[model samples]
Target: MTDVVGIVIVSHSPLVAEGAADMVRQMVGDRVPLAWCGGVGEGVLGTRLSDIRAAIDRAWSERGVVVMVDLGGAETNSEMAIEALPPERRRKVVVANAPVVEGAVLAATEAASGAALATVLATAEEAGARCRSVPSKTSAGRRQ
Candidate 1:
C-alpha cells in the first residue's frame, strides 16, 4: 500500500471533492493517499491552480499520482499543475478524463491493491465507461 499511486480530486465544489474523497476512503480505507481541493476563496465553486498544486503536493507518492477533474477549466488547470512539476516527475502524473466520483473510487481501490501507476490510471479511465448506457442487444442478442 505504501508504494501505490495516490489520488487527487479537483472539483468545482469543495463539498464534491471532499465527498468523493470520503467515498474513496470507504472503499480503500487508509491504504491509499487521497487528497482533494475545490472551490476558490470563500466557498466559490471554482478551481484555483494554486490550490490544485497544493493538493497534488499533499498526495504526492513515489509510485505516482492520478488527478481527476470535474470540469473543462479544471482539466486545464490540472495540466498546468503537471507541467509545473520538474520534467523528471511530470511523466509520473496523469490527469484522468474519468468522472470524479467513479474515477476516485476506482483509482483508490486499484492503488490500495498495490497496482502500478499505469494500472491504477487505467482503472480510473475505464470507470468512465460505466456511465454509458448499457450495451444494446441486437435481434440475435449480441451486444451492440
Candidate 2:
C-alpha cells in the first residue's frame, strides 16, 4: 500500500486526538501516515492555529491529505491552516465532514488500499452514514 492520502486529527483535547490516532493506528497498522494536534497548549483546553498548521505540515503528502476535526473551532482552525498554505498547496488539504474516530479509520483503510484523494475523502465523508449497530436499513426503517 502506498498510503497516498495522509490523515490529521484535530481536537480541543490532546487526549482525544491522541486516542483517535491510536485507534486508527491499531486498525490500519502502519499503512497510514497519521499526525494530530490537540489542546490549547500548556495544559489548557482549546485548539490553536499553530498546532493545526504543524499537524498539516507533518501529515502532508503529494497525493493529498484529509483532516478530521472534533468540533467547530477545530474545523475553523484547520481551514485557516490550509488557507495559510500557498494557494496551490491549499487544495491538497481537505477538512472532512465525519465523526473523527470512525472517519479516520475508514479513511486510513481507503488510503492504505492505494485509493486516490477523492476516494479517500469520499470514504471518510460517508463513514458516518455507513451501517452501524444494524446489518442494513429497510425502506420501512426496520433493521434488516
Candidate 3:
C-alpha cells in the first residue's frame, strides 16, 4: 500500500512472530506495510506455506517486500511461498538470511525510510554478519 518496501516476519512460534511484528510496529509505526505469520494452527509450533503466502499478500507493496524468518523450516516454507507467487510478484519478494527478530526490526526500519527492496534486505542481512562477528566466550572463559 505504501511506497516504502513491505516487511514480513515468520517463525516457528506464533508468539515470536507476533512479538517481533509488535516491536517493528512500535518502532517503525505505520511508515510501511508489515505482517507476520507463525505456526501451523491451534498452538502448534510450525511454519506453513499458506500462512506465509497470506502474510506476504497482506504486506504486499509496489516497492517490494522483505521477509525475515526463524529456523530452517521457516525459511523453507517462506521460499516455497515466494515460489508460489506469480512470476512478477515472486521477483519482488525475498527471504532474508538474517535472524528473524533483529532482521525484521532492521529491515522494517530501513523500509520505513523509503529504501529500495534490495537495500532493505541488505540492512536486514547485515544484522546476521554483525552478530557473527561478535566474539563469543568459550566454556574455558576465552573468546572464541
Candidate 4:
C-alpha cells in the first residue's frame, strides 16, 4: 500500500460508480489507491457485500480507506463488508457520509496529497456543505 490514504466508491448503478471513479482518476491520477464497486451482476442494479469487500481489499492501505456510497443500501453493504474484515483491517476503514461522486473525487484529491485518513474522510464529508454553499443561477439566469 502507498503512504496516502485510499478511496472506494460504491453505487447502485455500475455506470455511476465507474463514472465517479473515472473522475477521481482524472483529477488525482494514481497517487492514491482507488477502487469502486456497483451493481450485483448481469446488468442488475444493486450492491453486494462480497463486491464491496473486494473493492476495499483492492483499495486497502496502511493509511486507511474512505468509502463513499450513493445510497442507503450501498452504505449498509459497505458497513457489513468493513465489519467482516479482520479487526485490524476493519478499524482503518470508514464509510463517508457525503455525496458519492463529489465525495469520492474530493476524498481522492485529499488522499493524493498525502493527507491522513481522518483528513481525507473529513474532506469527503464536507463535500455536501461545500456543494450547498455554491452560488447557483436562478431561473431568471441571475446568481442566487
Q: Give me candidate 4's TM-score against the actual structure.
A: 0.89
lDDT of 1 by residue, 21-122 (tens): 999988779888889998886867878889988898888888999999887667888899899988877898899868889889999999998999999999
| 49-72 per-residue lDDT for model 4 (tens digits) | 999999998998999999998766
Q: What is the C-alpha lDDT of each candidate?
A: 0.84, 0.81, 0.86, 0.86
lDDT head-to-head 1 vs 4, winner? 4
**Best-performing candidate as measured by TM-score:** 3
Order of candidates by TM-score, top first? 3, 4, 1, 2
Which stretches of model 3 miss by more than 4 angstroms? 133-144
lDDT of 1 at 87: 81
For the record, the alpha-carbon RMSD of candidate 1 to the native fold, in angstroms, is 8.0
Error of 2 at 53 (Å): 0.8
Q: How well is each residue in 1-144 modelled by candidate 3, as lDDT tens digits? A: 569999999888889999999999998898889999988788888888898999999999989999998776787778889999999999999998887888899999999888999999999988988877642211232110
Query: Candidate 3 lDDT (Cα, whole model)?
Result: 0.86
Clashing residue pairs found in predicted model 1: none
Give a tens-digit lDDT track for model 2, residues 1-144. 224789999887889899999998888988777899898767777688988888878887888899998776787778889999988879888988777888888999998888888899999988757635432222332110
TM per prediction: 0.88, 0.85, 0.90, 0.89
Ranked by lDDT, top first: 3, 4, 1, 2
Model 4, residue 32: distance off in Å is 0.8
